[model samples]
Target chain A: SQTIHQWPATLVQPVGSPLSLECTVEGTSNPNLYWYRQAAGRGLQLLFYSVGIGQISSEVPQNLSASRPQDRQFILSSKKLLLSDSGFYLCAWSVPWQPQHFGDGTRLSIL
Target chain B: GIQVEQSPPDLILQEGANSTLRCNFSDSVNNLQWFHQNPWGQLINLFYIPSGTKQNGRLSATTVATERYSLLYISSSQTTDSGVYFCAPLVSGSRLTFGEGTQLTVNP
Candidate 1:
């Protein structure tokens, strides 16, 4: 069975602080990874996606960035966080053109 | 980019009641998926129906690709089923565009 794991299930960060969220998948290799953010009462917004290591595509321009350091490890980072950056961040993995499986998600609160 | 929309942004039902959720896409898609976001915020995959119908226990889904829409039917809802239902479409590429989701609350 494939499973996705995310670190720091919940975080509270000060404004302008650096941030990093990690995601890794077990039981799968070379799967596509994605980063999505959901604001309170809003739809999930695609922030970034990676098809392979060192390859990332940004869907919406914002302060956040994503990186794929290993075949199954993806990290979402920001040099300086903004109040608007607060949201529930989700990490998902899928085979090319297939349905995605999501992690439990990280609830980030930027103050 | 394909547009995905889910109807009845909010729904309330009594336990054991039957309910239907609808999802309409703006364009043709190669993939369509239904997910249940539990109260704890974990997304559980319910169906991967791009076309045709699939049933799983008390839940069933039908995707009319030709009409660019899909339907999810929940028979005999339970209190545990209270949560958000999301529908997303995989367009030309493998990226998925999610809908706003329909919030369903089943009362006991």
Candidate 2:
């Protein structure tokens, strides 16, 4: 019965603006959280992952960063967004080395 | 780091047809998963086959860990099955790396 929730189902941001996307999970504690971005017609790209609060691992260097402020809350943020930062952002949670459960993604459009 | 690849990048099948999607991975994986991303951009986990075969209704999945590959079989496809199928692998951690999905279209 675990569920993941993401906010601002759709977002439109002007270039050079700040960005913040939140993800929260219920029915589970101490689960792993991840942030992935998918560009149009492209594969899902791993941006960041956290195993616990205040612990995050970046897969690729980019304009975005992720933070696990709470056990079940993860936030993806950027001080200044770029045009290339536009994509569908997904939040996922999983047990240690297990299959992941994803939230309905947020479609971000940076114009 | 592990690399995952899915074959037949695009497939078109008529309703009631059967299709098999293949996933090949480099390096040993402790977890292999199949996901269906609907047109609405919701990702639904289809299978979590690490080293065996499992069947769920009209869908079945088989993973040969030793061979480093997995297969997802969809029987009697429906228009609802038209979407992107993604294969991802997890190795000793919760983070998963995904393969470029296979776009399947089931024409009604």
Best by TM-score: 1
- How would you encode candidate 2's per-residue C-alpha lDDT over A1-111 as one tens digit per residue? 898999989999999999999999999999999999999994998899998999999999999999998999999999999999999999999887568999999999999
lDDT of 1 by residue, B1-108 (tens): 788889989999999999999999999899898999999999999999889999999999999999999999999999999999999988857788899999999999
Cα distance off (Å), candidate 1, residue A93 = 0.4
Compared with the true structure, all predictions reach lDDT values of 0.94, 0.93
Candidate 2 chain B, run of 10 with poorest lDDT: B88-97
Candidate 2 displacement at residue A86 in angstroms: 0.6
Cα RMSD (Å) between model 2 and the true structure?
Answer: 0.9
Interface RMSDs of the predictions, in order, are 1.2, 1.1
Q: Which of the numbered candidates is closest to the native, going by highest DockQ?
A: 2
True contacts kept of each: 0.79, 0.91
Runs of candidate 1 exceeding 4 Å displacement: none
List CA RMSD, all candidates. Answer: 0.8, 0.9
